[model samples]
Target: MSMINYKYSFTILLAGFFLISCNGKKTENTRENNAENQITISEGQFKENGMELGKPVVKPFTEEVSCKGYITAPVNARAKVTSLISGKITSLQIRPGQFVSKGNVICAITSTEFIDIQKDYAENSAKFVKIKADYDRLKSLREENIGAEKDFISIKSDYNAASASLNAARAKLNSIGLNPANIENGKIYNVYTVTAPISGYVTSISAVLGQYADMTTEIAEIVNVNQTQLTLSVFENDVYRLKPGQIVRFNVAGSTENLLAKLISIGKSINTESKTIDCIANMETSLNKPLINEGYVQANIITAQTELQALPNSAFVKSEGAFFVYILKEKKSGNYIFEKKEVHITKSNDEYSAVSESLPEQETLIKGGSTL
Candidate 1:
């Protein structure tokens, strides 16, 4: 090869190397700038935009398991008022939603059976008195050796029978809500008073004035609101998170205030149909607002808690499928720069969220982060 041609080829190779080196340097600088990306805004602009900065707080972080249920009364605090005897309802003094006290007259019922029962009691009382007098006289005579033993024995048996008949008659009147002692010979009661068996608010009234009610008929239902309980349906997967005495926050449908309750009992078996366990909670305090039995409720059962670095819910910004928060990086003159740091949220409540990420503890995080 000629010397001039060789020199030219070598120079072309060196120029190619120089161009490759320059391109590589440019790519490295681009990557470095991208890695340190930040947003700079003047302090005046930050204030105009209502941006706020705060520090991460170490607060109690609670993990809650949500469930739905209803308000209910304990079995002992509720009653199904019924008539002991078949009768026509003469008067109903109470209505649904009315408060009633124990032993208070709830209604008046009239029945022919009431009169019959009183009459039988009166007649048996008179008969028993006469039998007792005769039996006593026979015993006296026999003691004086002037009366036959057979006569004494027979009088004794008749007296015993009469006494039993009177007792049975008295029990019948009592069962119908009529005191036998109050029933006289001519004063037979046709109307019997049905009294409230428990002190509570009437939830239902099945009997109306002039309506015939039998023993099987339910006249009314009473529920003691002070003993109201919250029953929650927890699935099997979350049942283990519940324990007696755990606090529960709940809200009834159409109610704005969150009510408080404490778990008292948990069912041992899961419901076959709903695949849930029954958890019963008593109201922490008597409800000032009226709550109906079987009213639907949305509940949050706080299962566990721990101290964690938490921030207000607004501090976390969501983009695409990832969550991020702004960390105050540097401030020069009147300008502030903030760098975005990705975070993982572990738990959250209405106000704050527990977060986990590789972040400096002393760094100031922007509050109301969504505004940015």
Candidate 2:
């Protein structure tokens, strides 16, 4: 009877243990299933959040900068006209604002010196003719053995000297702006006409219709407005950045009309007074307006050049005064992530900066914070 009691008690204990184990197992399974469901829902919510926020947007790269300059004539050279001889200005053929072609008569002068030149040429020419006749007569006599060799030689010598004197006198006349043919054409006494040395507009005329002028007096000033050039002064610091043949844009002072030009020269020496270096630009075309009144123009010279990536200032976010951009990065779980990237901007222009490193040239950058 004691053995039976023991067996029954053992059975009861075993049954109780089994029931507790099954119950614990069911609870554990239930908890695991509930946790898995919650995790799945959380993951779905995270993905949905990503979709609701929308995909990150990228922007095209651009730059920002500000520069200044002006416009001027491309080719400007001036020539001053002066009288070579003392005389009365018989006629002032050209006045200021007159367009004169090369060799066009500008003014006329009547002078005693011109009269002397013509008289010398005529006297020497007459002597030359007389000597030639004498020489011919002497040569004939020498061939006939009727003239002495010395006499013949003297006649030849006289003839050669007369010819040389005539040539010298004619040259002198030409040197003084007298034409040899004009002297022969009976125009020797005519007032000598001063011709234009270059093609351009007459800028200044000091000679009046009966004004007295001499070698020391300037009769007129001819400016080849076509040869007009521009002179610009740049700061010393910007001087080193200039080069010959760089394109420049120019505008008249207080005028919005602009013209294209190029750098002809850059001053090597610095000005002591202004502490600036002069830069010269040449225009490709001429300006028809009164150029003298074009006034002082501003110049913008490009000194330095470099190619670098640039972005808008808004693309960057400031943290502790340092700049950073939110770069789009892909996570290992196939999710897009925003990773902060630090960049160094070397030089800032009006709208952009010159960076030291090349950004993804072909790739799109994050447009702005709104895209995130």
Candidate 3:
């Protein structure tokens, strides 16, 4: 009842465990096969023809191109005035940043030598007048047969010599920035009134009171600031694209708004260092007050303008070597659909340009497609 009965019970328990493990293994294998058979494949199709495809959308574009640059004044329009004769500056009536007109006196010189020259001229002129009067009277008497011909001849010779001396003295005064005729004709006697050479603003002044000024020395620089021209240096390639009379918009380097201007001239030579050509632009409005300094300016010059179908530059997509935009077309299911179309960029400005393709009818192009 003890050993044999215990052995029988242990065998029965071992058999029960083996049967349970076999059943668990069979159920796991069946479940694995069922999972593999559950997999399904569906055919991929394009939006237009039910084939695999990925394309961008396109729509119509109409925009204008605007170029911009800065303001500038021409250098040739400025003038540097110098003295015409060597003399000490006794007085200066004009200062820097002053406006002057033609014939306005800016400075004066006082010289004893000039005084002596004037004295000699006056004496010589008086002698010539008296000598001519005597000669005329003697000649008249001789012609009437009442005076000696020798006397008339001597008087005539004296008159000619006096006339030559007066003429020589007058030329000397004229060369020293004085009008000899004015002195002789009593319009002016001794003092010299130096006049301005041109109408402009005095941008600089070197002539000081009680200083010496010579003919070769510059006394002041007068600039016609009102008639200024902006000179911009653009690359040689950009220079070739610009033409005279092209409208340009430009602003100060740090400004958000731009000013209007026109292309006046383009340089024919290239700058060796910058590899750029000099461009001249005349401001449409007088830049009485410029935002930037002279000598250099940052600018964008307009080279050309044309009409073309174009959207915002961001709407274009680039893949491989082609560019495209996404256009939303209406579908028969009463839902919006997007299609991709290729485009060729002919020209572009900051905001718009010319394109090589037209947009589809009744379709709206997707903007900012590049972000997609």
Candidate 4:
């Protein structure tokens, strides 16, 4: 009877151990499943994390690439007035906002360097005359067989060298805004005259009258407002949606009406500070409103329009250059399960993005969360 009691107790202990092991395995499996594709958050925590639920909606969406920038002149439209020779400004009659025509005299620089250039050209001209006389006489003698070949060859070389020196001096004087012919004719130029290279308004003058200027100094800037373009600052996230020749609609401050433009170029590099790509657009026609240089502009690069599954910009989260969203799979006893699912953004603007994936049946996405 004691042995039977012992066997029965042993069997009971073994069965109890097996049942406990099974229960532990089940708990482990549950945790593994939950961790694989789920997040559990209590209602209090959910609200604290600023979680919001949303359902994906199908709608007729007009996709656009939204951006903002300023109206400014392109590089080709801006004329940077600089001096080839350093000198003190003897005369700067121009003022800011004054209009200037191409080749109009803007300033005169009293450069002693101008005098030196003139002197060099004069000396080169005199030397060239003497060398040419010798070369001509030597050539005549060579043809007549009246001189040694070596002597004529030497004179010819000297003549060629002198000619090159004279031409160089002439070019140098010309570059310094002096005419070699005038200098040779005994015209003494003490001041180097500077002129406007392009027709535009004098936006600024960096020099005061009598201030010394150099090659490095920007004497003035002229801008032709007619050549102004829409300089759009497209964010990096939306840069991929843009291309050259795309149409852009722009609006200025205090105006609801849009100005039309066509995109002409997209930037190759991104702005590190603003994380934006610089884009340029030209107007389809003359703008009705006055073009303000460096004026602020809000723009939309019109891409396409179609019915799409859409979500707010906040609904998408980016990771490793890919986009993702969270969906509420189940709710039980105040615990919520949010399954992270990858998503594709076909097109986006400031507030909304069209997603390629539609929501699963009956599943609502975590449209936004502070934890994200």
Q: List the residue pairs that clash in candidate 4.
A: none
Prediction 1 TM-score vs. true: 0.79
Model 4: lDDT equals: 0.83
Worst 10 residues of 1 by lDDT: 358-367
Candidate with top lDDT is 1
TM-score of each: 0.79, 0.60, 0.57, 0.62
Stretches of candidate 3 off by over 4 Å are 1-76, 145-193, 230-294, 299-303, 312-346, 353-357, 361-372
- By TM-score, the better pick of 1 and 4 is 1
lDDT of model 2 at residue 4?
94
The per-model lDDT (C-alpha) reads 0.85, 0.67, 0.65, 0.83
lDDT, ranked from best to worst: 1, 4, 2, 3
Ranking by TM-score: 1, 4, 2, 3
**How big is the positional error of residue 161 in model 2, measured in Å on the Cα after superposition?**
2.4
Off by over 4 Å in 2: 1-76, 140-146, 185-187, 285-290, 293-295, 305-372
Model 2: worst 10 consecutive residues (lDDT sum): 57-66
Q: Per-residue lDDT tens digits of candidate 4, residues 130-221?
A: 99999999899888999899999899999999999999999898776666778889888777888998998888888888788888889899
| Candidate 3 lDDT score at position 5 | 96
Name the Cα RMSD for model 3. 14.7
Which residue segments of model 4 deviate by more than 4 Å?
Answer: 1-62, 254-257, 288-290, 305-372
- List, residue by residue over 1-372, the lDDT tens digit for candidate 3: 799999999999999999999999999999887554332212221223232222323333323233333344466656677665556877778887788987788777766566777777878888888998898899889889988888888998899899899999888887666677666665433444456777777877876776776677788877666676677767665565678897666666655666667888878888799786777777775565633325334556655444555555665678789887666543444443455566787756556444667655444343444533
Q: Which ten residues in a row have the lowest lDDT in candidate 4?
A: 361-370
